[model samples]
Every structure is written in structure tokens, then in C-alpha cells.
Target: MGIVVDLNGKREPQPSLEALTRLVAADLKAVNELIVRRMHSPVALIPQLAGHIVAAGGKRLRPVLTLAASRLCGYTGTRHIALAACVEFIHTATLLHDDVVDRSELRRGLASANAVWGNKTSVLVGDFLFARSFELMVEDGSLEVLAILSRASSVIAEGEVAQLVTANDTETGETAYMDVIKAKTAQLFAAACQIGAIVADRPAVEKEALESYGMNLGIAFQLIDDVLDYSAKQAKLGKTVGDDFREGKITLPVILAFRRGSEAERAFWRRTLEDLDQKETDFDKAVGLMGRYQSLEDTIERARHYGAIARDALGIFADGAEKDALIELIDFSIHRAY
Candidate 1:
């Protein structure tokens, strides 16, 4: 049985991305080869730094979505392979830039590119990857693909800027946070999935369905990520628990906790997050407060809601392994925090 009994004696489904990865293994391999080839540069540091993060054990989820979505649409051509590589380059570029912006030392349990090769190098390499992604798009000769990816790129930048504006502000509401993640994270996901249909020359309805599925899944994924930041499981996932809290990131957990707490608890949040006067013990206390208010649980509940929508969005597709794997992906996305 792929089910586990937790401490609460509840049956939990253990879902993995293996099904999707196996289904698209050949295309994924081609995408990987293309990535390696494109990442090469005469400048030694570009490849060195870019390859470091690219090979840092990070699950290529975005590109995998591209492959799976394309397959789901019955696309038999070689177009998706390069497009998948392009999606990965965009995602990888974001990770490099994010690490620099967050001043992060660790990425996927390894030293971050910025931490290893300075911020300037990381940013430049990120730019190089972005350029490579656009090059791939242009080479594909699809104006629609180019437009979708370029728009996603711009939206992702805007989302990053929005998050920066909201960071350290405890008063950042759920609506604002949703906007940030949707723009920053979900937009790329939407573009990736939608491109699959576009390449397949599917109808607008199928394209819209995929876009909806990707957007909802992206939101749920980010929500779980927020929950994981305060979870013990975070270390296992290669991130330091409470990095978000330490950086004064106003995630959903913190937002819920702050909104639901008493005056004293709100004051603690203000002092720690807004004032940035955190004590060493504050992280544990923050987690305790989140537990007290059931903020983490509620956040997971929110993810489930989005996951449901994502699953439903796929209802228009035929019943098959591709659809099953995509649906299970929603389960994996929501349950990974456990």
C-alpha cells in the first residue's frame, strides 16, 4: 500500500512525481542535453555557476509540467523537448536570481550559486539563462510561444518586485500575498502548461483548461512551500526551516497567525517581522504560535482547495495515464509538506 498511517492514525496517500517523470523520460533527457549544451559559454564562470545550481538536485518540476502537458495534448513532435528546456532555463534563472535576492546560502541542500560565486555572477548567469530561454523560443518559430513565455518572464519579475515590496510588512493581507504568488510563481506555470496546448494546436478551451490547472497547481505548490518553511520536514527538503521567518517574509502562515492572534501575539509579530528585532528563540516561538492558531493547517487547507480546482480543471481531458499522473501531481503537491 502506498499509504502511511500518521500519528493521528489517519491514512495518508504517498504520491510521487515518478509516474510523470517516467512518462516523459525520453523528452526530459533531450531537454537536459539541450540545457547542458546551451549553458556552455566561453566564459568559464557562466557554465560553472549555472551548472552548479542546475545540477543541485532540484526537481525540474516546471519543465516536467511542460513535457507532461504536451504529452497530455497528444503532441508527438520534438517541439516540446526544446520548449521544456526553455521552461527549465526560465525556472533555473529565477532560482539563481532568487538566491541572490534572498541572500540565501543553501539551494537544494547545496551551496547556492551566489554563495559560491558572488551575487554579481549569479545575476549575470541568470540573465544569460533568460537570454538562452528566449533564444530557444525564437528558434521554435512560434510567435504564440514566444509571447506566452516572454509575458510570463515579465510577470515573474513583477511578482518578485511585488514580494519585495510586501516583505517585512506584517500587515500584508492574504489578497496581496495571493497576487504576488500568482504573478511570480503561478504565471510561469500557466504559461508552461498553456504552451503545450498551443504547440499541439489544441482548441482555446483545452488551452484555457491547462492554464487553469497550472495556475491553481502553482498556487497550491507555493502554499505548501510556505507551510514547509516552518516545518521540520523543511531540512529534509534541503531548505533551512524558518528562513522565511528570519528574512521577515510575510507568508500565509504568518499572515494567518498575525491576523488571528491577540494583541500580544500581534506585537510579537510586529517586533520580529516588521521591526526585524528577532531573538534566537523567536523562530520556535513563531512556530508555536502558528500551531496554536492552526495557521499551518489552515494554509494546507487552502492548498487543498486550490488542488481541488486544479484536479477539476483536468476533467475535460480523457481518462488515461497522463491525466492520472497529472491528477496525482496535485496530491503530491499538497501532501509533500507532510
Candidate 2:
């Protein structure tokens, strides 16, 4: 989760939080410089489209995680900044393509890139960003970072394909859901933290521990995202409620609801999912049914489980403000805006 902690008086120090905010503030400038320089290049319309989306404000969670993890490992270097920017570039690229595929209208309270630019341009620009991210990673010159990010990007691509194939399939169980979330969300989180360790040249044990922490944190973060899709206000979410249902993306809450609902509820799930285009009332009824059954609570409990595991993973690190901040981050992911 990309959380900004208010570290006020009479409390333990928070090195990770402090470092993360500073890194974001600083490296965001670097990324913007790179974007503008590239925009002036004679690339295709796709690169131009990508530049627009990349400049749009987001929490910059992946890059922040990279910088924080490196600081927690006692790193003192400028390369971490460039590496963090690389992570954000890759993440932004993924979003441009994802919005195009999902046919989404809104993201981060703004019109989606694909909404303004055509799908072809969005996808092509996303590819340019991906290539640019690789160039930045190579500049960092850490073989481990390169390997970790490369594998993670591959896993993310596979996860998106899996999601498209499994959407609206009620037979999708918890195991399948876990696989999808781990690949799509957790992979990048794990890579973000692992790269931090690589940049710091930390021992193998500590690096692996941070990777575990990030993977659990990523899973928990996505779990909350899934819950919010059904529960949050449209303004807060920057998107419509039941948007996933309308798109036939059967997330954890919907899966739980399907398993626990009565026969009529089961039939309702089928009607909404199997039918090509469902009415607005159909989506509304599905939301009402899930609310009645407390399916959101079930999903939240699952998120809490992963959050606890992430916090526990931090125990391997020596007690410091950085570790304290990491623990609080887990809490933020669990209790966030639900």
C-alpha cells in the first residue's frame, strides 16, 4: 500500500516513511524530466499518449517501496532514485494498457488515458514506457534487480491473461483467486522490495525476508482493493461501484457471495455473469445481495490475515524507525478507508 504516515510527536522514529516521502518528492522530478525529453523525440503517437498518462498523479507506491526498502537496509546511494523511477515507469505502463483492456473511463479521479487516446495509441505508448523502464533498470547495473523485475513483469502479464480467462466463472475457487492476485499484484510489490535489497547489497537472508514482506503486503493491498470495488463511494474510488461486476470480473467478495448465497442467489450470479450485457438493476441487485450476506466482511477478514503476515515478516529486520514504519504500513493497508 502507498500510505503517507503522519509521524508526529512523542513516537518512535520512522526512517522508512521519511525516506519514502523524500524519494517520491525528488524522483518524481527526475521522471518528469525524462518524460518531457522523450516527448520531444520523434517517436510515434503511442509514446506521446504514454507520456500524458505517466505525468498524471498517482500514489507512486512501487517506487516509494523501492526507496524505503533500500533505506531500511542502510543504503546511501543515488542509484536508488533512478531505480525507483524505473519501477514507477513500469507500473504506469501497465496501467495505460490495463485501462484500455478494461475499457475503464476513470482512474485516480481523472479520465483514463484510453478514454482520451485510442486503444492502439495507449497500448503502443505503454510498450514505449516498458522499454524505457528497462533502460533505466540497466543503468542501475544490478543483475539481481534486473532479474527480479523481469520475472515480475512476466508474471504480471500472465496474471492479466489469467484474469481475462477466469472472469465471470463462478467455478473459480480461492486457490485460483490467490494465484491471480499473487501474479498480478504481489509480483510487482515483491520486486519493488527485492530491488531495494539488491541496491543495498544486503545479505541474502535479509533480502529474502523483505521480499516475503512485500509479497504479503501486495496481496493484502489488492484484497482491500477488491473489497473497495464493491463498497467504496464512487468519488473516493474514482470509479463506479460494482464496476468489476459490470465488467464480469468476479473478485473475492463476489466469489464468497456466490458460495454462501441461496439457490436464488446462485441463479442471480449466473444471470449477471453469463448474460452478455446485464442491466443496471442486475448490478444493483448483486450489490444488495452481497451486502445482505456480509461478503465484504469475509473479504476484509482475508485482507487482515495477509496484513498480519506482512507485519510479522518485518520481525526479521532489526528494530528501527524503518521497521516501525513498515509495520504501520501494514496496518494502513488493513484499515484503509473500508
* Each model's backbone clash number: 0, 0
Following a full C-alpha superposition, what root-mean-square deviation does model 1 have from the true structure? Answer: 1.6
Point out where model 2 deviates above 4 Å: 1-24, 27-40, 44-47
Q: Pick the candidate with the highest lDDT.
A: 1
- Model 2, span 181-296: residue lDDT tens: 99999989988988878888889988888899999999998988888777755446455676688778878888889999999888888878856468768877887887888888
lDDT of 1 at 98: 96
What are the RMSDs of all candidates, in order?
1.6, 4.1
- Give all TM-scores, in the order shown: 0.97, 0.89
Number of the predicted model whose TM-score against the real structure is largest: 1
What is the TM-score of candidate 1? Answer: 0.97
